[model samples]
Target chain A: MRKMTKIDIITRPGKLEELKEAMYAIGVTGMTVSQVFGCGLQKGHTEVYRGQEYAINLLPKIKIEIVVCEVPVEAVLEAAKKACRTGKIGDGKIFVYPIENAIRIRTGEEGDIAIMDPEDVEK
Target chain B: MRKMTKIDIITRPGKLEELKEAMYAIGVTGMTVSQVFGCGLQKGHTEVYRGQEYAINLLPKIKIEIVVCEVPVEAVLEAAKKACRTGKIGDGKIFVYPIENAIRIRTGEEGDIAIMDPEDVEK
Candidate 1:
């Protein structure tokens, strides 16, 4: 069984398209994208409501999850940083975790085969 | 020095409400929910497009991510299974990963403290 790593990238919503292109360029095609609310170190900006200031803790963010077995983890990280970085807070964070196994429900393919792109498999 | 685990649950969107209630009942409050697309072994279903048959490979799914330290991992799994399971194809999957660390952006809290519910901290 090959080792698999799941990379969870939470970044600015505006960077999705660029990020996708970067991932595709790196041969990382299998991904799950979603909208998420992130509450991080930024302290958030204050919003005034009827002469009162309230802190909005949760901010809208986009999360992209990709599990890789063939691509180098470093490559994915570099691509993400280059595409998503703005040298500012709210640029988001990345979390890496070890995946014990992954199974494809339709074909029952497991591990690396379960997540690989067909084009990669053909090559 | 608590161990933190991240559970990623991908399930039918209709079960979201039930899953949320289950998590709340178990004192698991902090979660990130997102809409995603899952492609698996199901082979997809056929759809007519312009009088032509097309295979829809991707299925819409709801992914909920939660990082837990104090709450028992098994409990979360059980609750999720109970809420999301339909004993049929496309029921989705659950993946568990080891979280090296977690941080709260606003207060700079790290590890378990960063993810615990305030109510849990008070107690």
Candidate 2:
């Protein structure tokens, strides 16, 4: 069983789909995105101009999370970087960590094979 | 300093706002909501037809997370139960764990004072 690497990504909502597809291109489709607020090394926040609430989230950011085998860690992360590039505040951040295991409830497959990207294995 | 307990909540998107208010009523703000897929003690999944994406999320679940002081843990959890009541499969589950410390990077306040609920501390 390969150790799964979880990526924490924050990018604009508009760029979310592109980022998701980029990960898919890297053979990582089983992923999750959450509307999240961040205030880490960057201190992501929102600002108000008019009384109207700008869903633009002065601190608007999307968290793209994917669990992938360690072998493809760098590829997946790099793909995300390229896809979610704004080179500015609110563009987001990516953090990686080890995922001990993953399981597919439908197929009853456990570990990497469960949520494994079919494309990566062939590469 | 009180230990922070993290709560993992899974409920319908429709019930999300209500749940948030419930947690807030219990003096828990500063939480995060994530769209999630679950198949835990209950196998949460989606059904598809017509090849059209249904945002209804047949297995839609919301994760309501709160960092709370130990003393009010029970109260917060109870508030959630009362508010998010479907008594159904997607109603979700709540798990609590200990948080050793919390820091408000902005205020430079460490431990309890940083993210402490003003209402809880007053009581």
Clashing pairs in 1: A40-B105, A40-B106, A41-B105, A106-B41, A106-B42, A107-B41
lDDT of 1: 0.75
Per-residue lDDT of model 1, residues B92-111, tens digit only: 66666787899889788888
| Fnat for the candidates in order | 0.21, 0.04
Interface RMSD of 2: 9.9
Candidate 1 C-alpha lDDT tens digits along A1-123: 988898999998899878877887887745777777776543656533345654754777888888888889999999999999988656789998788656543344556875665445546
lDDT of 2 by residue, B1-123 (tens): 665666555555687778777776766758887776532221133333345433323344666777777438667666777777654334444544456788878667778777776565458
TM-score of 2: 0.49
Clashes of 2: 3
Q: What is the C-alpha RMSD of each candidate to the true structure, in Å?
A: 8.1, 9.0
Q: Give the TM-scores of the predictions, in the order they appear.
A: 0.56, 0.49
Looking at model 2 chain A, report the run of 10 residues with the lowest lDDT sum.
A100-109
Interface RMSD of each: 5.3, 9.9
Per-residue alpha-carbon lDDT of candidate 2 for residues A1-123, written as tens digits (9 for 90 to 100)? 556666677777788667656765655645555665654342344433234433345454667656666438889878878997866555666887654444342332446664543334335
